[model samples]
Target: MAKIEQVLESIGAMRQGRTGRFSRGVRRGLYGIFDLTAMTAVLALVVLIYIRFYGEWVIDHRADALQAASSAVIEDRTGTAVWRASLPEGGYREVASAAEIPLLVKQAFIGTEDRRYALHEGIDYTGIVRAAAVNVRSGGTAEGGSSITQQLARNVYLTLDQTWMRKLNEASIALALERHYVKDEILTMYLNEIYMGRGQYGIKAASRRYFGTAELNRLELWQIAILAGIPKAPSAYNPVDDPERAAGRAKVVLGLMAEQGVITAAEADAAAVRAAAYEAPQQSVVDAAGTAAYAAAALREAARKTGLPEEQLRGGGYRIETGLDAAAQAALTGVFAEDAYFPPDMGGQQTEAAMVVVDHRDGEVRALAGGRNGDGAGLNRAVDMKRQPGSAFKPIIAYGPALESGRFSPDSVLPDVLQTYGGYSPRNVGGVYRGSLTMTEALTRSINSPAVWLLNQTGISQAIEFAARLGIELGSEDEHLAIALGGLHEGVSPLQLAQAYSVIANGGTFRSAHFVRSVTDAQGQEIYRFDPEAESRPAMSAWTSAALAFMLRNAVAEGTGQAARIPNRIVGGKTGTVALAMKEVSQAANRDVWFAGFTPEWTAAVWMGFDRTDSGHYLTVPGSAAAGLFSAAMGKMLAGR
Candidate 1:
């Protein structure tokens, strides 16, 4: 009986302890509920205050929200964009609406980004929570919980710096965007506003840059996945620079889509195979000066004609439409690209060459080549290099001026013996001389003695006047008898050579040679126009032009310039060679050679010699080398016509 009473007492004590513990647990549960309720109320009040005040502030400034979103692109004659300028901050190309975006692309973004993007308003609370956990574990900003609208708000409305204040502003702006625009509009703005790698800003440009196509809908599933993964870390996943990382990111995007049932396992596998084989083309190495190399002369002309700085024109959102023929430029450049064109037998050591072609009818510069395989911008030899014209200068200095003098004609007799004038002696090549020859024979044979004798009779002043009329900028110190032998204080550029020859080709008319046809804004409103016809004026009489043309025609037909003869075509040309001597040097040094000519349709000039290299090394090659290149390039130019 005593043992049974002890057991009952122990059981009663245990029951009392359990009841007391249960009462304390109930109290602790109530306190926890109250704390959570208080926190929720505070969060609600803060959000309400933000929406009421900051949202109204954003709405008040809605007028300033939109920004310019187009890049200034340079177009070729055929309306093809060959180059694009840098985009301003908050700028992009044509926006693509969500509907225009491919469905596969959309699903890929949604799956890889916020899986519940459709359900979220502007911010995904679940993503934020998960990101917070991830960040806390990593001790860094390892994840961004931003939805598409949030990203758009951050890119357009707020600065890109990462900070709590910026985050708060981004959230506020994102909420406002969601209310102001529809879901599709928000997505469209986000897609276009984000920066893709390789200087591209929008989906349109990114599509064209990466895949070489602007039609995003035509992209394969793997391509769409690759693009979707790039926005997360553009530099790390840029397909052009880092293909393996891009492929890995793309695989992750595919896995996300498969998990979301957007694609099946077999489809994902097939897409993965395609993605493995995906490759972007290797970009060609462009000239260091970029498009400015090919278009430097054109840009200068634009500045001169518009009275604006070239820098201003480059940044003024203007589309420069040039009359530059791509094929002709290519053909001309290709002729000089071959090392064989400058053979060692021709004294082509360290030789550089330049050529310029103009459509004399309209003064449009058709082709301009500065150097072989050059960067195109530096020292544009065609327009910038000014060297002695050698015998090539005779047409402007001796023959044209003599014809314009009204005292000389193609048939006029001139003395070609060894002559000395004021201690200056002129002799023909190889020190040979023809006693007396007609002006036509003198020019066709490039007899130096007769050219000097004519200058003695006609005077240097008349040659200066003729060159000036032809728009060749002669130096003040160029008043000398040596001018008769293509000696000028500052020689002429290949561009000037081509332009001056145009007067002979086009019946003595002087038309300013230029490159740009017009410059317009993005809206196609013309800002500048080149009027070649209006600029045309007679530099010499028709009789002088006829006489000069007759002599020049004979040059190619039966003269030193025979190498430039294009079969089956009425071609005319002149050959020029000058022995250059530096200070303390004599005339037995390196020589500069030239060939300047014109047909009815074109006027071209070719210069070959060592300009920046050793001036002591003479070019053994004759002017014929330049003429051959000129002939070949001109042949291609005429073929395209």
Candidate 2:
């Protein structure tokens, strides 16, 4: 019995040990689970912090800054601003928000783009997660739950580059926005800031193009949907070009509206009907001609300064008066189409020409014709192409120095003969020496030997200094002896010469040359305006310029420029011809011909040359007729002025 009790005690002790072991195992398992749960909660908090603070805070501000900069625009003098582009790398304009935006249009845009806009700071993660889950199940970005603030953040500050870094930045900026501004204010800003296509930027411009009014409700739901898709691809989904694609995108917008409860299925169907009833609008031929790609290009360039998209500029409803004179434009364009002495029989290509007309009074550009009939016919030879000015540069070398030195005047006589200065020998045209011609007579005749002799008297550096002050951009590496003969290692543009001549025509005050004026953004903010920089130095004195003018007049009256003479007009001008300047050392290729001229009211220059491979031939006539085109175009283009 005692042995049995001992056995029972042993059995009971073993059972108790087993129970302790089991309890210890259970406790270990519970501790492991608690640690895991704590770690998971901490991770979730970290993710939430990133989404709430980094994604929402810092990144949102960057978006606003980039968007604000990209959305600003400069305006035309007519006050009509164009903006179809929101961002620009190499484009022309920059634009901003409308200063005079209609209040009703703002309300409509807010209602359409973000209904819960003013309530949330920026992102709504619950909605975003739901959209994400749906997106994963089906390959669609069809559901976007971003509030107006978040959308603005993405559009303005962030690039569309889908990198992990970019995603983090977007979230940070969105959160920052929530911490900073009130919801209503953000809504207003987003409505004014986002891009709508077709040079229409804001809701107001969109309303004008799609609905023909600034009021929003008047638009068919389809039109509204179409407008909504413009931010995605303005050029691709344009209704005028791809109606089917536009309609298809409209359905997607309608689907989103239904999902958001902004519209019902029944309402969406009715809106589709209203949209189908819409007939595409047609532009009047008159309006269409004036609103061409060229005008569009200029407006885009002007608009780029505003920082707004091109769409906003077209419908901004302000007059865009230009310095362009209609009569001058017509006359200048005709010159390119004028019969070319070159053959049409040479394989059916039309001769191309380019010209720029300027107002001598203030250096305002009157016209720039790129080609015949404004068709971009000629290589833009007027402004961009740089060719040797030939003898046309002689005025600066020969005439300018003479005036400044007080050693020679219009009436001062200089001996004209084959002259050697330093190691260089220069001869007059045709190598025929004419002795003792006055400054006026020498300039009219464009005598090279007399010019060289004058250089010996006055010094070449003095001539170059005069040229540089007048905006020639001539460098100091040149031999001053070359100044007498107008030989340089480089060339210049005719348009540049025209600008320089305008100063002399206007009593010697240099005005900056300009093609663009001002820019405004979608919100009507004047973002950039181009004004002439103040003159830091004088180009010349009026008395000296007047004396030079007296000499240039003799050029047309008695020299090689007699072909450019205009009856009943008091004109002053110069002619240039250089055998070496127009050819290679072998004299195989003729490079260029030039004529720079001015009347009492206008100044102009002309250059004709082959840029492909130098043509190895010279036009004895253009040195005659290039200058004549101005006299002819002047009668037609500037008849009134």
The prediction achieving the highest TM-score against the true structure is: 1
Write down the lDDT of every candidate, Cα atoms only: 0.78, 0.61
Report the C-alpha lDDT of model 1 over 1-641, residue by residue, as the tens digit.
89999999999999999988898898888988998998899998987788556855775677355442655555556765555544444332544556669878778877886677788888899999999999999999998788887787777777888897688777777777777777766667677777777666767667777787668888888888888888999888878889888988888888888989999978888887777777885542121123445576776777787887776565455677776776777666667667777735233545788888888887888778887655564689899899989999998988888888899889999987887788989767788876888999999888899888888788788788889889886777988888888988889899999999988898888988888888886455888888866889999999998888888999999998998888678888898887755664555554688999988789999998776535445676678888887788798778836
Model 2 whole-model lDDT (C-alpha atoms): 0.61
Best by lDDT: 1
lDDT of 1 at 388: 88
| Per-residue error (Å), model 2, residue 332 | 6.2
Question: Estimated TM-score per prediction?
Answer: 0.75, 0.67
What tens-digit string does per-residue lDDT give for candidate 2 at 59-115?
444443534333232222344332222334422222324443444334434555565
> Can you list the residue pairs that collide in candidate 1?
69-92, 293-376, 346-621, 347-620, 590-618
